[model samples]
Target: MGISKKTIRLYASAKAVITQYLYLPGSHRLNNVIKRIDKLGNSEVESGIEKVMRAFAGRHRNIEQTFLNHFSRIADQNKSSLEYFSLQKKILLGAFFTKEYSIEAAALFNPSIVPHPDQQGLKADEQRFIMSLRATGEGHISSIVFQTGIIDNMANITLDNSTGYFTPLKKRLDTSYNKLFISKRAATIPEFNRSILDNLPESFSAAEASHILNSIKPTEPSIIDSVMVFEKIMDNNYELESSSHVPLNEKVIFPISNAESMGMEDARFVKFHDGEQYCYYGTYTAYNGKHIQTHLIETTNFDVFKIRALYGAAVADKGMALFPEKVNGKYAMISRQGGEKINIMFSENLYFWKDFQILMEPRYPWEFLQVGNCGSPIKTTKGWLLLTHGVGAMRTYVISAILLDLHDPTRIVGRLDKPLIEADENEREGYVPNVVYTCGFMLHGNHLIIPYAVSDSATAFATIGLDEILRDMKL
Candidate 1:
């Protein structure tokens, strides 16, 4: 288990914190806030806006436009037309409705790494990467955030500084909905009437779905309840786009759906290579406080993301990681259903996983409490290199490795007898103590770079020679 002290260096400056702010409406008092703003004198409105812009305008892009947009949203919610208002009044009123939220004020942890889409300026041995972390704020609500960095030939890591402005994704309303998919999903609910969706075409737009739902007669309370669920289903599976002009590090994938309103936790992103096409897919757990579901996020250039719910029986539970590529002509995934043992599943459809088989169980003391894959399985010359997290005494979390037969990944090849990374004294205190975990890892020029979270409070990087890990793994 010996690894050279010179080989591993923790990048302390790589820690991620909340530098971005989101605009949210004032809770419960929105109606009152609007009424009070309407009563403000013209001179008072102008002076208030002037002071507010001087204090906050420099921190964001298009501050005036954001305010106007917020005002428009408030107007729409109150079912009012866009009445003519002085520009100064709009700015002042928008400030009243808006509040700043520090998105990652509480904790930032459980990061996953993937090769960046663009690597134009790098040297022959250098690789650019995008690391996604779960950022939790005031309510312990988590969202996905990014950091871009580069690893040179010498395995030295340098992360890019944040752009100092947070740009949230603009949800696209034009995204289409699938009728058959909704019908199948809704069938699981006993109150849902399949015939209600039978009239819609195979593929329809959101507006069309709304029309159909409104046209239905809600003669019974059960029917009304079922209609609400159907509308929520459509809303849950939608698309979002980032401003192309914004830096990748400043863009965030926040919780946008009721299914993920509680948080989007631990996204394991992988660049899947299928034939000549390369698409990035991240599987994350979507929690709505009362229920948890598996969701898939797909992006090709990182500018736009398409999110949808994963289906079938095996889709239950959290920490589901998709393989980088197909295995034996079928998509593969690593899942932990009951949170006790590691399991593997294969399916032809990326969204539907109907079955799973026990892949690995805790065989050593470090992981005797439970075991789960850290992220996606990494393809390597030796085999499919998989990183795992094992929970032991005191609920202590440690990172370990498992090697699977490349062609037949269900077959075990080698596994590390000891954890590759564990919390030392310096890393043992934070929001959660005695824990070291990651959502993914990447291989760069024979060096396996693992971006992990320390005590579920901050992030740090650890690198080790690929050969050193492969040599010590027990077959």
Candidate 2:
């Protein structure tokens, strides 16, 4: 009735040494600060710049250049011209507006594992893996960070040391939006007018949409509310990318859009093959401090990412996981739209889905509360193995497993009546008590590598024999 428990290894959490500097608005009266900088003497400006360079040169790359970039952004806000200020003075002024942020100050958990694309110089039994984690910083905001390592022949885990530097992704301003999708969403708003969207192209940028909205002269006060809604929708659908020089582990996918202003939670990453090429795709929940929405993140090299909003009636709730490949010539996904039962959905298009069917429900006492998929299903020789989470008494969360027919995934073949892994004494004492969760897992050799969160605070790893778990399944 119970599976054997194995050893679990704890990883380092929230290293203060790794930090990213952000450009912040210094004071309420920014114009006065700029004016004061313009009056500084030549020697004073040179001395200030020298001091800042000496203090922060070791902490970041090209400190002076970063300061200049910040200064240029701040100068754009000033009413007066920055032509009078010297280069040194501008750089010095930029230092005052820059602030250091610790990316993982709060916690690091909810890990997802995928095989590294570049797998060279590895032993016969060793496979390289890229691990993505949820790094919570100040203000309880969550960002996606990564780590790289290998699983040896003996099933021992070895993680590479991080460079102690984190780079946030830059928003790609040229990202376009679909006019049809926008029109459909706009119809739900009471004050939105269909005529205002007439002349727009099939695809357009945020700026284009804003210009169209501004040109309309509505006779009612509710038009202001409609304008606000239009702006928010544009903000939710944007793109972000990181520099090529930044390593995979050093890149941080922080929330840039208003829809995810609060946090980007529990990304379920799967390395998918679409017949011609392979790409990495992740489904995550975006929280805007008030409401939650579903988002899809795409990346091939892990250096750059394209994030977009997922639209559909079935994508209304959290815990959405996509299969690694299409089933019956259509893309398939697992979701819990009702928040209690597991549902399967298929779509010809990746972004929009409208069809769904009930897959499973709470039958066992331990899962009477609710159930959801843990990550994307792992295809095996037996069937499509799906890892799931079930909530029970005291609001405790536990991981379980189920098997589905290979060709017809909608047909359930077998299930595990008992929990595979549960929180132990040491794991049940963090931010949320009695919770052990994971976004995904990987299979290496004969072992299943599970990187799981401990009470929603930190991350750890555990390995289970693949054969043992398969033999223990109840058909």
Candidate 3:
């Protein structure tokens, strides 16, 4: 009944391509490369610079500025040696150290949608929205990328065209850290030296923390864990800002910390509301090749982001979706700590979590393997409408829905008797086949708009009546 009553439309123009590239600096053999570049005579250097600019400048925005920025990454001693050279020669040297990396060459999927912060110029039924997706490039490294679009009254999605040039964000290390907070978060580490942390001032700078951590001369193997813990925590926290001239869609949040050295996967972004103030919060899994942890991200606008690691037992698994507002004066999160069932937790502190209650389990054949929330729950007059995904036999993934009481979300109200949506014949083939997934979705007017991944390779959209879904859910 559910499958026959609804029709899903796929946008043919909404797919990621391999042409977009980020201007990344290559640091391998830097000293040798600089020496070789210095050996070039004036005429050779000038001619080479001109040729490089002519062929490559058109492909990037502010190519010369990017080259200069890459040049600044070289050691001060190397910069002093190059001071005698002309500006053109220096720029050419920077170009030699830079390479282009396509941010989405492999796949772009798992998108979550939130209303755009600036919604000034829209018609009565037109809502502008921001969508974040996981862009996988070379090395299978995944990063968060954005797309802006508008949903009309008819429930059609029109994605903004790319500016043709994608640029990476400029990362700034957080200048300060709270010593007590750091110690508390790191307390779970077996060899963490709380004594050293106790001696530090209440507040400290990153340099101070590093100095203290480095000064420890380990007498045993366990002490090394203290240093490693400090370093990883320091690396996990940082701020990212986009170039003023870069469009939202062109700015990419690549991995900058050791905690997510491998990738940042499946960011579930929600427009969080507190009192009269509002900001965006996202929970994503940070993978450093060997281990995984949940990280919390905060931003008022899409241009700037503050990312930090989430601590405590409830965050041990991936797919932690924050509710739009606090539940009974505490922040609420839906998580899958055990990887088999959907669980819910509340926290007084946003960065830490300790307790959770089982919210749902695998009840049917389609979800006999596991179940998880597809994104943040959407508040409705009836209840909190949550989109979910279930894994059945052959690890097949299908998107479904459930309802929770508004005041006390821990109480289940209604659930879907069958899958809301699953992979179609055509949608079931890509990077990871037989899977349909989404990090988040949004409710517009009477329609629920779902932007889902097709086999983990590309993204597509689906729209169904909110009333139809509520009616189908079993109470």
Candidate 4:
């Protein structure tokens, strides 16, 4: 297969990056590194370039960073480095480069030679990568490009409309491309084990569905700290589970906290465990009640705890809010002013109540004069566990956890000497950082399921062992 001028440019662009590392004088260590790039396998300068570029950063930082700056650049004012070209360049940068700074280092030089024959960025075949995304819904943004040459020039593009790249001339069929990268397309999709896409509204357009498909993926714009997370839902409610443990009462009713917004959105009961069902607590911003949680479904006999609501409720005159979780027939809680603590209270029976009316109080260590920030709680084998997120003067909230006695809830079984988990650059730099909040958790066999809202736009999940966390909770 003969390479077109455009492909040749992309190929050369990739090759130039390698020569600068091997042939260009630098720390002989950097030069020595390129030989390994050469020795890895047989190559026509072109294919060799791809192999070297892919492996360059994997082995070391110095060379990869040199090319990355261009990859990360939103605009190509410099127009002089291997990173300077199409989305494919950035794709390679993300796959090969390690530390973000490594890619940043590559930005130093403007790449002159095109990787292809005509020195263009992406070849047409590469452009097809974006086209495969099928839209199932709406409100999406995508990036696309078009080959609007003198109509006579048979030049190709790395990205395109039919193949899912960005273009300047708007065709009636092409979706709007901001190139600010607000749009999306599916990069990887497993062969269907049988995909069931329900709740598809008829009002949405094909372009809109494609845009949404892009959003629910591990895309470059959505990558956090260079790590991409593919969530089941790009943006939706937190996971709700009916307690796995069967409750004493078979008819436990969850009061609809946010009934108006949820009921209209197709809220219904989906059984998780044989007898476990999740209550979809929803909210309505159109009305003055956004914090309202409504019971969308009910499970006959189960054990589930509403974590955030445990703390959001204002105590009579405590001057601080407390959050509580009922675990193993015991209560685990944390307060805004108090650290990790719990107090099992005795309560009166309701029409079909299942929990003990245990009084829960703030269980903080005596070390801090001020109360600790409030956090979420979950049950663990070690004890009744809690993840507290307290606020500092900057209004910054951090995520942390500690454990309590499984039997007698008041006992301060263990406290995290320090916060076990906190915000990273991703959570800290977006709409809001220093804040990691979990509405609830799913105790799946051994792993603790934690789903958190990111900077408030999207949602993600993290898994940690129940026992490993207990190991860290030192008194």
Find the candidate with the highest lDDT and give its number. Answer: 1
Clashing pairs in model 1?
Answer: none
Candidate 3: where is the Cα deviation over 4 Å? Answer: 1-28, 76-81, 195-204, 211-224, 242-244
Ranking by lDDT: 1, 3, 2, 4
Give the higher-TM-score candidate: 1 or 4: 1
Q: Per-residue lDDT of 1-475 in model 3, one digit per residue for the tens?
A: 3333224332222233222222334544677777888899989988998898898787777888877766766535353556775677678877886776766777888999999998898888999999999988878888888899998998877888877666777676556678766877787566787666754677877778788768777777666777778777877877775455678987778887888988999999999999999999989999999999899888998877888898877778889999999989999999998899999999999998989999999999999999999999999999999999999998899999999999999989999989988998988888799999999999899989889998987788888889999998897
Off by over 4 Å in 2: 1-28, 176-194, 201-204, 219-230
**lDDT per residue (tens digit) for residues 1-475 in model 1:** 5432223222322223322223345544666776777788998888898898898777777778878887777777674553766777777777766666667778888999999999998888999999998888767788888888888998788888777777667788877778777987776567886666766778888888889878987777877787798888887788996557878887878888999998999999999999999999999999989999999999998888999888788888999999999999999999999889999999998987889999999998999999999999988888999999999999999999999999998888999998899998888998889999999999998888888898988788888889989998899
- Clashing residue pairs, backbone N/CA/C < 3 A, model 3: none
The residue-by-residue lDDT of candidate 4 on 224-333, one tens digit each, is 21121122212111222443442111111211223222211111111122124323221111111232221222222223322111111222111121123233443223
What TM-score goes with each of the models? 0.92, 0.90, 0.91, 0.32
User: 2 or 3, which is superior by lDDT?
Assistant: 3
Weakest ten-residue segment in model 3 by summed lDDT: 12-21
Q: Residue 111 of model 4: what lDDT? A: 12
Clash pairs, candidate 2, are none
Error of 1 at 313 (Å): 1.0
In model 1, which runs have C-alpha deviations exceeding 4 angstroms?
1-31, 79-82, 187-192, 219-226
Candidate 2, lDDT over the whole model = 0.82
lDDT value, candidate 3, whole model = 0.83
